[model samples]
Target: MRVFFSTLALCLTASFAQAQCGGSFSGFVNGLKDEAASRGHDRQSVDQFFGSVRQDPKVIAADRRQGVFQLPFTDFARRLISSGRINTGKSKARQYDAVFDRIEREFGVSRGVLLAFWAFETDYGSFQGDFNTLNALVTLSHDCRRPELFRPQIFAALKLFENGDFDPRRTTGAWAGEIGMVQMLPQDILDNGVDGDGDGHVSLKTSAPDALMSGGKMLQHLGWRAGEPWLQEVSVPDNLDWSQTGLRTTKPAAEWAAKGVTPRHGQIAGTLPASLILPQGRKGPAFLAYPNFRVYFEWNQSFTYVLTAAYFANRLEGGPVFDAGNPEQGLSGEQMKRLQQKLSQRGYDVGEIDGILGAGTRAAVQDVQQQLGLPADAWPTPALLNAL
Candidate 1:
């Protein structure tokens, strides 16, 4: 009888979870609470953690409207890497000089890199975000569209709550459930969080040292190489093979130098394999993306954002402002979506026809350009679309 009852209970719980995934919002949250109890969390704590987690429709709206990523690289970078942001980053670097020094020594991550993320993520902790974190996480978890990506985060947040580090009702952050100054997700905090201020508690939201150091540790955990360059501005010769541009193709720095890919300022790692990325096109700002640049993708998957952050880090390290050349105008959002559809029809995996020039879309554009005898700079144009 005991064995039969246990089997029946398991089947019922499984069915309940399945129903919750796409059913009413209240049912979904109940499923989460039940699952927490099953996972060894005490019922009282689980109830406390989720008692007030109202679903945030605004988070769902923000998740669906990531249209800002469609902006051209020059415009995006220019908007993000403002002079004031740079000045503030430099000031923070000085203010937290000792913390940064310790971070570099312990984690093998750069201060410039951490400072750029700090400035960009929350403007040196001036604003971490305003959304109720528990609500956002619960909402996103209940959302069927990418539930797998967000569902686990709710449990991680619960662990923080259990530790007295999180307040379900009061803890606020980004709409995506990222908490603290660097905008880290809950799992990141659980896995890589550091208490840099020597204060037994890891106060990432209120302590600059904790935030910066924790950010550094997270980067290191993401496979950041010690003291190695991530991005370098470069001058690609007019005669250089445009087909070899884009991150899909990598060549030794020396091979690129032999082809007249000169560094605009700092020394290039001679033997290190690097990809030549023309963010706008061959005519626009060019950069050599080093091995460390790949790790930025682990932080944020958007190619444009990772590039801008890396470039800003370089600027913080005293690199010159990029010379934005006059590249041809790219496709509008709808046009780009149409282009993606065409590419998909042609058997190229452009990920989604969302109108964003993501890495997959760019790669598809490059392949089509090369096939059609175009410049193959990976910057989609109306000409290419018309040709398709």
Candidate 2:
């Protein structure tokens, strides 16, 4: 009996050792190696790629701690689309007029819009992040939170390596695996990359024209309509119906004009379809978002971010600043989380308890404001949290 018990303990110890080894980071990478091989990637190359990768905790932390969605449009825009950035974009448009002219002629995407993307993505190529592309993508793929999204990106990166478009040792980018001056992901690099500089290779990191042309091609593929406005700042009358002040409702310019909505600068043609966006509620700036605005959302999901890009693009083209009054500051992350919790407790579907206040949270805030006889502008404030 003693011998049998000793043998059983030894077996259990071996089993635990095996489990620990299989659960290690190296083990996870090995599994990816096999998966890549099955997907027809060269085995030697896969091994070479995996050998150089180290899991990046900083990348994982950044993915989990994004707070940009919580910032108010005014604060976000003011920080990103400053006068310096606008002037730089304008100068770049002229400095690279030959390149921009060619890209626009080919892709039908405006130079200002492409420059806005460049400025926003990496400060006009001044900084394009420092994380290793392979490390970030592999680590993100191993994480279970969104494996489906990042796994394909890993394969796409591997394909880029195979095609000589990326070097695992030298390919560094955003924590989320976006590369180059315009901050495109590996999948986008494979799909929309263009050889703009006549180098016979699409090198977005080293070549400005390549990045710009690739970005322009992407925008064109994403349905950017030539000669269409993305959005314009506008004034909303106090007597206008508050229920129709969000992206969910759309109306012709004539209908909005009849309801006392007009451009802050000049009259808009009545034939255009537009939706009102009160980024800061009725008290702050408003915008009339046109159909071309959807293409901006396709580039970046944050309404505030897309709006900033569009506004910066317009500024690059010599447009005026918003005539609407400056927006009040938005809630901090802690305040936003508290508001989301309160809304959830009150039977509003604010989705996750994460601090980012997205469309669902905004809608819930609007419902609460309506119930409490408040202004119902859907904008969260300290007072709104206190009232709840």
Candidate 3:
């Protein structure tokens, strides 16, 4: 009877998901329009908001092709941070010196962090993407993968439309429906948008000052400490405990110091809490991630991407390049999937077995390594897979 009920529950869940996700596209759109009107949005405004909305297959394609995220931190960071991008970031910082200064003063967000994001997201507004904003949002909302997250943004976009800020026929941006220079969603703009140029409108796309200030405000809203460091490159002793590494474990800076964790440069706060992150394992580059570093995850969830962006922010502030030490090669996508399967079978919740070395998978690997008396460095290897 228990097995029968579980099967029935599974069937019900599949049916419910189908009802919410894979139905008629026109009906899904019409339901959205009805919701807007019900929420007291003007009929004309609602009609105009979704007028040109059409499913963009390209957006869906872009969403699925995020395989670049599967790459190791070293390779991914190398692809993103370049001398040319760094130079351009410096130039932009100087050009908008006054704006950045004001942003730092008002929002307590440093120019280096915002500049790194601006450089990476749209290359200093060189390309903010060319997809239709409304189409992208509506299409993603109608799709099954992440409707709950995207559906509300459609309404937020409508609010922007009502305020004369967004255009369904135009307003191109990232395929994820984020707009303007820093690539923010409509909801984020509504909540944290700023008029840094004093133009009475929060125009993030065309206005550099507005984008920088708005991005700064958003970071502050995401729990950025007023005057604290985020990422700092550090050196760890060879005999340091491997299980103590990873983001899950944190110790006071003094405690880490006691463990022979030395800053590659300046001193870390003695009392401040920090996590020793061995992104490519203990053999590779290491960083002491502070409280402010957690905010980067709120910005972007990819572990490697967040680390790279934070490190780039440090670089913009004159931080030195990292030393890429020799590390063992990690498991490929298939091997990772197999490892995740084994971990899950042993009662570890490794989130989707998508073959990405995410935090969950890393934690599970560390636990299994400890059990097998192996180095719990959190870097998956072929030997670990064989042991499993």
Q: Which candidate is the best by lDDT?
A: 3
RMSD of each: 7.0, 10.2, 6.3
On residues 1-388, what C-alpha lDDT tens digit does candidate 2 reach at each position?
0000111112233322332122578888888898789888889999887779988899878887667666777777887877788878888888899999998788888888889889988999999889999998788767766555566677778888888898888899888888899988887788899998998999989899999999998888878777667778788888777767777778897898888887876567578888888888887888888888877766676667778788888778777887547555568889999999999998989878878767788788887888888877788889888898
Please identify model 1 stretches exceeding 4 Å from their true place: 1-20
Higher-scoring candidate on lDDT, 1 or 2: 1
Better of 2 and 3 by lDDT: 3
Sorting all predicted structures by lDDT, with the top scorer first, yields 3, 1, 2
**What is the C-alpha lDDT profile of model 1 across 251-336, one tens digit per residue?**
99989999999999978899899999998888899999999999888788788888888999989989899989888889999999
Candidate 3 displacement at residue 358 in angstroms: 0.9
lDDT value for model 2: 0.79
lDDT of 3 by residue, 1-388 (tens): 0000111112233323343554888889998888789889998888888778898999899877667777899998999999999999999999999999998999899999999989888999999989998998888888898676677778888998888888889899988888889888888899889999998889999999999999898888888898899989999999999999999999998999998989997888888999999987889999999999998877777788789899999999999999889988888888889999999999999988888888999999999999999989999989999999
Error of 2 at 29 (Å): 1.1
Assess the local accuracy of residue 273 in candidate 3 as a C-alpha lDDT between 0 and 100: 97
> Model 2 residue 25 lDDT?
81
Model 3, residue 214: distance off in Å is: 0.5
TM-score of each model, paired residue for residue: 0.94, 0.89, 0.94
